[model samples]
Target: MKNKLIKMLVGIGLVMGLAACGGGGEDTASGGTDSAHADAEKIYNQKCSSCHGDNLKGGMGPELTAVGANYSQDEIADIIQNGQGAMPAGLISGDDLDKVAEWLATKK
Candidate 1:
């Protein structure tokens, strides 16, 4: 009975983990993120293009995808707000930042 109970708990845990993955992260295509991203991209071109390149191909600043695959949207937003390594803070704000994060993640 003890062994059976442990297996049952493990099965439950696995199911819960899978369900957690079906998260509610906003989709850029249909949501307000689309327009927001447009706003953010314009901010990028104006404030960041000099260092990161017009398309974020990298110039004075590291490529936007420096570690793209490993980061999440929230993490990117925080980075944008706090600024990283060679980047400065407060260049973008609120909805614009969130949208940029979504666009950057899809780059590669």
Candidate 2:
């Protein structure tokens, strides 16, 4: 399985997801100014911009804004963990998945 290949990329055969990731903006949690969302955008710009676009308007990958319509944060997390369409799974799991979902949720 391709997942296996990805898993193999780990150092010393450890099992870890592909990206540095975590849950959504914590500023929303601590009653901050949604700085967490800002962090999410920054993360997206660095990791997802290549395919999804800087503004998330769409490019090689589907447009990220309003992705929550078809998928929830949890679902998106799954895609990040398992791969979909032309995307490779497990590349954006854990924190990174949460970050993307948090940013995408605010695309409205």
Candidate 3:
């Protein structure tokens, strides 16, 4: 009886451990995409909205509604990092630069 109880507890622990580990992989994969978009939106609201408009409708900066149609991802990223005519350079950097560029590319 003692041996049987010990085996049962070990089995339960193994099953619980496996279940916990299995769920995290899937959640992390999906969560990355969600997190990137959320981060992008946050960054946009904080830095770009002042000039670009809250909805990309054009404020001090021009309307960005169809910016994706006009520029490629690399081009946009470059413009962001290097700055264009009246715009300043490097408003965002690192992973944020990539995320914001990707998110804006979907604006079309």
Best of the candidates, lDDT? 3
Error of 2 at 31 (Å): 8.0
Residue-by-residue lDDT tens digits, candidate 3, 1-108: 999677556644543343344311111245577777777777777667666788889766679989988988788899988978666676676677788798888778
Give the TM-score (vs. native) of candidate 1.
0.59
Candidate 1, residue 32: Cα displacement in angstroms equals 6.2
TM-score of 3: 0.69
User: What are the clash counts of all predictions, listed in order?
Assistant: 0, 6, 0
lDDT of 2 by residue, 43-86 (tens): 66656665667777876667887787777777777776787776
Candidates sorted by TM-score, best first: 3, 2, 1
lDDT by candidate, in order shown: 0.62, 0.61, 0.70
Q: Give lDDT tens digits, candidate 1, residues 56-97.
A: 887656677543586777787788788776566655666566
Which residue segments of model 2 deviate by more than 4 Å?
1-33
User: Of models 1 and 2, which has the larger TM-score?
Assistant: 2
Candidate 3 residue spans exceeding 4 A from truth: 1-30
Ten consecutive residues with minimal summed lDDT in candidate 2? 10-19
